[model samples]
Target chain A: MELIKVTIDNKVVEVEKGTTILGAAKKVNVDIPTLCHFKLHDMNIENKPGGCRICVVEVDGRKNLAPACATDCTEGMVIKSHSVRVINARKTVMELILSDHPFECLVCAKSGTCDLQSLAQQLGIRKIHFEGKKSSYRLDTSPSIIREMNKCIMCRRCEMMCNKVQTVGALSAINRGFDSVVSTAFEMNLKNSTCTYCGQCVSVCPTGALTEVDDTARIIRALADPSKTVIVQTAPAVRVALGEEFGMEPGTIVTGKMVAALRRIGFDQVFDTDFAADLTIMEEGSELLNRLGKHLAGDKTVKLPMLTSCCPAWVNFFEKQFPDMLDIPSTAKSPQQMFGAIAKTYLADKMGIKREDLVVVSVMPCLAKKYEAQRDEFKTNGNPDVDFSISTRELAHLIKQTIRDFDSLPDEDFDRPMGESTGAGVIFGTTGGVIEAAVRSAYELHTHKKLPRLNFEELRGLEGIREATIDFDGLPIKIGIAHGLGNARKLLEDIRAGRSHFHAIEIMSCPGGCIGGGGQPLHHGHSSIIKARQAAIYKEDAGKAIRKSHENPDIIKLYDEFLGTPLGEKSHHLLHTEYFNRKK
Target chain B: MATTEIVLKEKQVQQIKDICKQFNNESGELINVLHKTQSLFGYLPSEVQVVIAQELNMSLAKVFGVVTFYSYFTMTPRGEHPIDVCMGTACYVRGAEKVLEEFKRQLKIEVGETTLDGKFSINSLRCVGACGLAPVVIVGDKTYGAVTSADVKNILKEYENK
Candidate 1:
């Protein structure tokens, strides 16, 4: 590759050809503040519209200041990134952005985290000079997301994430000039559009325009009620990422501290979603084996390449985009729903509490879990099995509001019965984890023999799409895995065209699975944080004594004492769900 | 802007599909397809955009975005007779605003709206490159040059019979 030399702020640097001025400046340790420019370096996702002029820099011999993000660095070009002329222009642009923005930072959901707010602070903008009519619009609230378009800056990062990364195409830049805003067709509510509620758009938005619906208040109300028995369940991914909100390093395991904190917050009992993840393995694995047996017996009606139905957003995607193939995914309900069903039935009955009085709260690393909890199929009569589902970020906020010293809290253990889980359940937080967990138990059940190895390293990675073949006593089982919804679309197209050869497929709607979920602590366009969390999940899995779901004693005892068996009549009604056509 | 609900007939839906097929259903030809579809239906409503989106295999939001970005596209139906008043710089200096106000007062409807009888709809446009005819007003295909506020009543009388 060719090289070019440029001088930024009196510091000379050499960079590769076609490098942006911002890139060249970074090499010389020159900082140029920016907005509407986002990138996940390891994930190959970037949104560089350069519509914001906050990064404008003075170029020698050029009449106009150039935006550092979009301007290419030329050889022998002299640039001043922070000269008087450039600083004045950047401050003026900041004032213009704030002039039309609402001054509700004290109560805004994204006050401290908002990029626009931070840029104004960095530029020392105390007051606005140009005052005019501030654009206003109706606030839209859906089951999982809230859209406040009045605070939109038209950065288009959310638009890029929706259309380019996830391929859900639920939002676009509508109208022109001052009237333009990202919205669905006819400015319809998100619930009426093709939005899967994956929350990827919420993750990339620089302002409070997009956010997950806050459920912390409702959860606190349930906890305060004397008649309600509120129990909390934390997903495996939340443990690895929740520490970031408390000034801890990324991927710090806070399982024990989180449980202690929940107990301190007045929960009647604290459970783990990992236990339900093990139950999912039992149900999903049996379903897989049942289909494989029928397909091998020359049952032409059987559908091969069964899809995993653990991710709510993925389920919504196929239901909306590929409604004809709804029968192909496993009918087992997600781990969150399965836990809720059991909590409302078996757990409530065992503890002598009424079903309606028992409130099941889930702390998830997902935004879609909020929507999944409200699904009609998971409800009995008019009462939903899961009363409230809050994101990992909301949980952190609740902890800060209730507990004084979270870091100093002593280590604690989860309650008996539903808190026990195996290593396979803990791994369900990352990509390829659900299928790998299924294979661990499915292999032993199918062959009636002990497997030599436990770890299937080939199935795990950060790739968009992956394929692996595991030998179940010489019967090769081809498996496919896709993390992002865009990659899942490609795999679905292959299946529709009769080009698929795999026996099963696993799909996650988020980029790096639940660890990079939209409801997790904001990574600020950094994929390395997601990678760190992925490693932490595997580390927790390896540290456990029993690595297989079938070896969990509590799971076996529950099956023997309360439930009859996997895929039994009781299991079908409580642990399984049906899909609907949502294309219209 | 509030839009009344519009349900297209089966035949109208087929016509939109045929227009998309004429462009080979390519997403790049969305502008051309929209132009042809609008010519057939007089305006692009939400229902018709839904059909075009399905035929082109693109998101409805994307199609709507393109439609709203261009000023020529309209989501409301036009009347039998459309009246356009030039508001270009040349016409604005020649008392065009007064002429437009007279039409609004007489028609009892604002710009971009049709009369209750479906007779006439008013709109403002940029330069038609006819500066020589300052304050120009066009009703259908006939152009009126140097038109005044008093002439607005006569223009409505000519269209009342048609």
Candidate 2:
């Protein structure tokens, strides 16, 4: 690699030829504050619009301060990051931004974690020098995400993620100059637009401009009602990442602590969404095998590559973009919905409680799960299967609001039946987990032989798209795994063109599956946090005695006592759903 | 601005499709296609922008973003007699703000707005290259030099019958 020497803060540092001054400053530990610069190191996703102008630094020969994020280092370059002139300009630009911004940080949802708030504190800004008419916009609340354009810093991070990374094309920087703001087409509500409610936009927004809808209030109300028996199901991804809120490391596994905290927070029964993940695998695996069998038996009518429907964002994506191939994805509902279905039916029936008296709440690593549970098909007579779905971040807030010491909480086990899960279920938090879980069961059922080894190393990785061929005795099952909606789009287009060769495909909307979900603890463009969470998920999976979904005792009992078989009529009614053609 | 549902002619729709095809329907050439479409349709309403987006294989929001970014583009149709008041340094020093305010009063419309009768629309421009004619106001292509608050009503009366 071509090397260049640059003097940053009077310290000479050698970096690659194309390295930005911001990247080179880390060598000598000189900090240059930035606002609109976001980079996911390993994922090759960077959003540096150079619009904020907060990272302006003085160059010796330049006419004006250059943006450190967009400026590349050249040989023998002299850069001063914190001269009085540069500092004054940076502060002035920040003041201008603040002038147009709303001064309601105390009540803002993203106040504590907001990048702009911290930057103002870092700059020691006491009072605004300039004042103007702050931009006001109509508050837009969708099923999963909320848009408050007044708090927008014009970072364009959400715009980049929506159009470039996720390929959702739902948001863009509209209008110009003082009126310029990121909005949907014609400033229509998100529900009317083609937004998939993936929450990638919410994940990247630096301010309170975009956030997941606050459903914790509704959950709290349900828990306090005397007539209600509120049960909460925490997704597998939440366990690995929820501890980050309490100043713990990114990969800290606090599953038992999370369950204990939930119990103390007034949840009548604290269960695990992992159990439902295993249920999903049972139904999805059986559906995959049935499709593969028919395809093998010369049934051209059946769709070949059966896609996983655990990701609600991926479901919404194919529904809007690939309406013609809607039948390809498996009809199995997501883990959140599956848990709600079982909790409201089989569990409520056993407890002799009315469905109306039982409230089902899910803590997920996804914003789309909120929309998924509220899906019309997942309800009966206007009652949703899952009454409410809160994000991992919101659960942390709720835990803090409960007068309970989250860090000092004692470890506790989940409730019986619904809490029991295998390593296959726990692994569902990561990108390759769902497909690996499905393969474990599909292989044994197809070959009528036990898996020699449980781990399919070929299917496990952080790559955007992966394909592996596992030999099922004499038959080879070609499997495809894709995380991130953009990567999913590639596989989808391949299938649309009859180019895909896989029999089963798993697609998750987030980058690293649920571990990198939009509702997880803010990584702030750090891919390492996501990798650490992925590692913790695998660790949880490896420590379990029962590794496969089919081997779980509770699942077997569930089949025997309640739901008959995997693809039985009862299971189909509770666990399966169909897609809509939202082509407009 | 209200997005009135205007029924575009078959020829107009075919003409937009031909303009998009002229640029090979590349999404990167969105600005150029939008310029052509706007020139043909007088303004880029939602219906016209929707056609461009579908033809270019882009989101309507992206197309709208590009169209709204540059001041040269407009989403609303311009009135029969469009007015432009110079707000450059020279014009401002010569009391252009007073002239603009007078026009808003007489025409009953703010800057970047149209009168109820659709006969006049007012907007502000940086410079008309007529620095000597400071405080200039242009009605369509005709330029009025050294315009004052007193002349605003007379300018409106000139375009009243036309």
Candidate 3:
């Protein structure tokens, strides 16, 4: 890498050749405000279209201002990032954007967190002089996402995230110039498109154009209903990231605070989705062992390299993209759905609550869980097992609306039976977690021996795709892990071509798994936040007394009392699900 | 814009698949494939775009994006005698809007809509590099030079009885 010296705002800095002016300016602590330029370091995802000229900077000897994000630094290049001329140009560009944008900040879902809103404030844009006919489009509301394109600034961040990162090509910049907007095929409903409802687009959107469907209103109504017994289940990933909404540092573990807040918010019972994650490990692990045993016995009928179905987005991805390989994934329901099923059935019976009267709500780190809760297979007699699901961000809003001084709240424990979970279950929040959890339980169950080591550090990281081989008492179990649908596509194509060598493959639609899930607090294009969340998940896992799922006393008792055994008739009815080929 | 649900014929689907195979089904050749498909089918409807998308192994949204970005590829079915009024700078200066309004008045249909008899449809296009002709009106394969609002009736008369 060749280094070049550049002067930005009278501060000299050295950067590699081909480094953008924005990159060189950052080394000298010079802030160049941007709207369209977004990068997720370590994830290899960037959206630098240079379409929004808000990052324009004055350059020596140049006739016109250059976009700092796209302009490369050269030797002895002099740049003025905050010069009056550059600031005036950036303000004009921002004013033009605001002129076309809707003035609904008072009611907008992204009022405080909107990048566009903050940029306007930062630029001191009190009024727009270039106001004209604002482009308007039909508001599209899907089960998991809402598309309010009226607020779109055409930054193309969502388009880049949808196509370049997730590879779920449900959105594209259609039409031309003035009329261009990111939309599905023929401007159709998102439910009808190839969208997996992964919410990766919503995660990257800088404006209110894309957002998770606000299910918090529905949840509040359910909680206010006295006739209904509302129970809330918090997913593992939510524990590590929920505190960020309350001004805590990223990866701050707020499990106890969250439970206490939920209790204050009027929930009759607060449980842990990690418990069902343990339940999933037992059922999915048995299924994996069963399939592996049959494949080793030369049974060509059994499907090798079973995929983990813990992610609803990954499930939807395969159902739409790889319809033929539906049978390859484990039939176990996701931890969210598993919790709902057990809560409506075993827990409801134990507490003497009627099935119809019991309301099961989940706090998940995914938008797909909102769609997953409403899936037909998870319903009985037009009533869903899970009444509804809310994202970790929604949970934070609810806490803010009900509790005061959340940071100073005393630590509280979860309600019995369905609340106790093992370390294996807690680790399901991060990448490589589901597979690692399955291995811990599957190894002991298959060999009928106590494992020497607990943590399989080989199966963890921030890599998009990872492969690890764990020795199960002489049986080398090959495992493949892929986060982000694009990387999952590579593994799926290899499997489709009969080239995959692994025995099990775990796929999460979002990058960095559930810790970096679309419904969590936005990382604002920071990959370090995801890494911190992943580390916090492992920290929570290591602190638990029982690291293996089978060792969880409540999970053991649930199987002994009500479920009978893993993969048994009762467990299959409650814990398993089938996939559909939604190719069209 | 309202679009009616359309189902392509079995043979029409096969034709699209063949055209995609000719282009090696490369997603990069989407524009070329769409042009060829539109030429064969007269227009790129949603049904035809779906077949092309499947053959190319690309998302329908992507194929639709390409089809919509260019003015040449249309989703609606064109009339037997499609009328295109050049709305370029040169043509606009030479009473192109009046010529377009006259055609729309005679056809009893809007710019993108076809006549009830399916004989004529109107569309406004950019420059056709026929600046010397100024206001040019194209009907089917015939081009009328320096066309006026009065010439609109004559152009419709030529398409009639054919």
Best by lDDT: 1
Candidate 2's C-alpha runs over 4 A off are B7-11, B88-95, B128-137, B141-151
Candidate 1, residue A147: lDDT: 98
Candidate 3 lDDT by residue in tens digits, A1-584: 89999998888899999999998988889999999999999789999999999999999999999999999998999998888998889889998999889899999989888999999999999889896889989899989999999999889998898899888999989999889999999999999988998999999899999999888888889999999999999999999999999899998999999999999999999999999999999999999999999999999999989999999999999999899999999999999999999999999899998889999999999999989999999999988999889999888888878888999998999999999999999999998999999999999999999999988899999889999999999999999999999999999999999999999999998999999898999999989999999999999999999999999999999998999999999999999999999988
The lDDT of each candidate is: 0.92, 0.91, 0.92
Higher-ranked by lDDT: 1 or 2 = 1
lDDT digits (tens) for residues B15-132 of candidate 2 = 9999999999999899899889878876788889888899999988898888878766778887888898999999999999999999888877888787888888888888878999
Best by DockQ: 3
Q: Write the per-residue lDDT of candidate 1 for residues A47-161, one digit (tens) a residue.
A: 8999988899999989999999999999999999999999999999988888778899999988888888888889999889998888999999999999999999998999998
Q: Give the C-alpha miss distance for residue A242 in model 1, angstroms.
A: 0.7
Quote the true-contact fraction of every model: 0.74, 0.81, 0.79
> In model 3 chain A, where is the ten-residue run with the lowest total lDDT?
A395-404
Better of 2 and 3 by DockQ: 3
As a whole number from 0 to 100, the lDDT of residue A471 in candidate 3 is 95
Cα-based RMSD of the predictions, in order?
A: 1.8, 1.8, 1.4
Q: Least lDDT summed over 10 consecutive residues: which range in candidate 2 chain A?
A: A400-409
Whose lDDT is higher: candidate 1's or candidate 3's?
1
Chain A TM-score of model 2 comes to 0.99
